[model samples]
Target chain A: MSSRNRIESVAHQTVQKSGLKNLSFRTLGAEVGVKSSSVHYHFPEKSDLGGALIQRYRQSLATTLAEIDDASPNAYDAIKLFSKLFTQECSEGKICFAGMLAAEVEFLNESNREGLQAIFNMYHTWLLDQLNQAGDELKIDLPTPTVAHLLLASLEGALLIDRAHPTNDRLSSVNILIDSWFGKIN
Target chain B: MSSRNRIESVAHQTVQKSGLKNLSFRTLGAEVGVKSSSVHYHFPEKSDLGGALIQRYRQSLATTLAEIDDASPNAYDAIKLFSKLFTQECSEGKICFAGMLAAEVEFLNESNREGLQAIFNMYHTWLLDQLNQAGDELKIDLPTPTVAHLLLASLEGALLIDRAHPTNDRLSSVNILIDSWFGKIN
Candidate 1:
């Protein structure tokens, strides 16, 4: 990878493991096997680095959603796939950057805030589509956008709870809690 | 107030505005009208200081919840009182410490993790009581524990969103959203 890409990649991990609030360009440079000055040569300030990091995170999320087989699978499979992808992302790191940023929305820059909202909207749209399909196939009264919002909020909260407590089984329990909600209502 | 209490009062604002990840004794001492060394006399290290702050937060929440009239004019009023107290706490510069810790769960110490879980359980129990009362009064089949969890999760998520977006309107909207949900099913 190029120097800029290398810096972004390292910065991504720093922000994920620590927090965007704690992100430091110097720390990121060390992680990438470069000096702070060298990293600054590409991105002049923390805000500049942060903006780029947020954009890259958004792009990655979009790409992940794009890879899902929304058309090929039944509603159950599609929704499961969707939740599974999000859970995997959380287990791999902390949370979707957008969701994490949304949790601290008061602190995000304008560009970052907008980016986070856009990512959530995309996820919501994908969820709505899958739910509609599921409703048709199974003849269920799937809840509306508000319910989708509730599920999204709960899933994020559950992950947050599990990581705080650090039980090995909690991640799977979170998935089961979400999956069962759909199944029971359907 | 004592020097320790003063430090906690200042640290609460700094953490609520800048985040726990950014809290520092030097900065807190400056805010509390004390020398950094004196602050150290009370809290020798960051962990000690953080534990004190967490304890103060727990006390505040307990006091606030106790002030709420569990045997209010009605079940709905009791719920309103509880939520109003939450919004009050957040606005007073000590936003939900548990919610903040939840965002950075991977980076916290064990004491902090346990502290967060304990606070959440306290809030959860209060919510369960309120929901149970509401169910009895309203004579509805709402899932008390589940609905309570969903409401608490939504409120926390909404606070983050409101902070990022910076709006009093969103806070009001959150209250309405919670009230409406219970009203609908119960």
Candidate 2:
């Protein structure tokens, strides 16, 4: 792989395993079989590298959501599909990187914060679109904006709980709540 | 201050600003004007210090919740009180340490994970008691376990969203949703 690719891959793993704090030149250098100086040659600062990682994560998530554009979907199915995707990601031990970074927004640089917002924006836009489509098809009253934030926030939070507790039982318990909240409307 | 208190103060700041990955004896000692060896004199291993910090955070949160008991004789008041306390902390740019550690549970030592769970257990216990009391007064039916988990998860997740987007407006938006859901329930 090119040095840039190698650096991004390494930083991604480090963030995945240890979060943003451990994304340093020394760590990336070790991971990529390069010296810290060489790592710096490709990316002048850690923030720049972080910006790239954030962008890559956003793109990857966007791509994942893009793949599931089913035709003729109703509001309930749309919500269920989103929940299924979220729960599957949690089960795989990964979650929305933007969601994770959001927990530490006070500490993030301006650029990183904007990048994180872009991820949420993408999610909200897609979600609103689905909700509109579903609401029209199902002829149901729904709280679009509130439901949008609720779905994202609750899924992110549930992932934290499930990971901390690490029980399928707990996850299923949460799914019941999600299903009830969305199911009644759909 | 005692060496234990000194180490804790430093770890608290580190956890607040940079999070657990940046938590180390050397970094924490530097924050407190001590050598890493001197810090180790107080904490034989990193886990010893981390475990203590987690305990301190739990105690502090419990103390905060204890104060709410005075204002929360009924369920409606209790829920409102809890929401106020939670939002105030988030708006002040504080991420709950247990919540943060829970995200990193997959990477944490067994001791750290235990500490995280203990925090959650304390939180859930307090919430259950408050909800049960409120339910009786308000005549609202709530599934104690499910309600406990839902409230905790939604609040934590909303903090992540508000922190991520971080407009003053986002806080109000989340508060509205909280009121709409939890407020109406009981």
Candidate 3:
């Protein structure tokens, strides 16, 4: 990896493990085998680094969602595939990076905050589209926006709870929720 | 409030506003009108303060839940009251204290981590009892534990997302979930 990618990689891992608050240039320096100044050379300000991190993360998530779209045959399978991303993160003993950033939104700089918002907007829009497409063929009881909000919130919340207690039941809960929603669909 | 109480109060607000990561002795001291050393005097270590904050928060939550039980007539009402507590916090532009702490759990010391765990346990147990009682009299499609987990996770996750975007629809989404669960109950 290049220096910038190396920095982003370590920063992502740190944020996932401990949260945005625990992330610092000094720690990144120690982990990346560079001095703090060298870390600064790549990104002068923490917010700049934060902005870059979220921008990269958003691109990666968009790519993953597009792949799921291409691979899944139906809306239900698409939703399941999306949820597995969060489940996979929890199974590795980390909260979703976006969820972690969401918790620290107030602490983030303007650029970083906007980046986080864009990521959520992307998720909400994508989920909304899936629900709408499914609702056309199936009977969806709640409004698409509400269901989209619920899915995002529930999955993110489950990851937080499961990480704290570690019952390994988040994926099951996600599955049950999806099944329940489908039962409502028609 | 006593100095200790005052310190805990400020720390709680800081954690809710920014996150546990941005909270510090200096900030607490500045907010509380004391020196950093004075803040240290109240709690020798940062973890000590974290433990005390969660302990105080847990006590407040316990009292609130008891009052909700005393005031609410049925499962649905009790659930609404519980959700209102979270809504009230969001209205004040804050995340639930426990939810904020959960995001930074990996950075916390053992005592603080256990304290956070205990808070979640209290919530789960309380919600589980309410769900089981309601399930006995009505038709609850999902298992009591699963429903309890869903309620807790959704509420917490919604708070985090709502804070990031400020759509003012978290309460609505929460209501829809509760109503859907109740719809299942019949």
Best of the candidates, lDDT: 3
Question: Among these predicted structures, which one has the highest TM-score?
Answer: 3
Pick by DockQ: 2 or 3, better one: 3
lDDT of 3 at A84: 82
How good is the docking of model 1, as DockQ?
0.32
Interface RMSD of each: 4.5, 3.5, 2.4
TM-score of chain A of each: 0.84, 0.80, 0.92
Alpha-carbon DockQ of candidate 3:
0.59
- Assess the local accuracy of residue A163 in candidate 2 as a C-alpha lDDT between 0 and 100: 73
lDDT of 3 at B167: 83
Residue B63, model 2, lDDT: 90
CAPRI docking class of candidate 2: acceptable
TM-score, one value per model:
0.80, 0.81, 0.93
Cα lDDT tens digits, model 2, A126-165, are: 8777776664443323366666675666667777776787
Model 2 / residue A33 / CA error / Å: 7.5
- Model 2 reproduces a share of the real contacts of 0.50
Please give the fraction of native interface contacts (Cα pairs under 8 Å between A and B) kept by each candidate: 0.27, 0.50, 0.66
lDDT (tens digit, per residue) of candidate 1 on B85-110: 67666773345567777777666678
Residue clash pairs of candidate 1? A105-B164, A106-B163, A106-B164
Give the worst 10-residue stretch by lDDT in candidate 3 chain A.
A135-144
What lDDT does model 2 reach?
Answer: 0.69
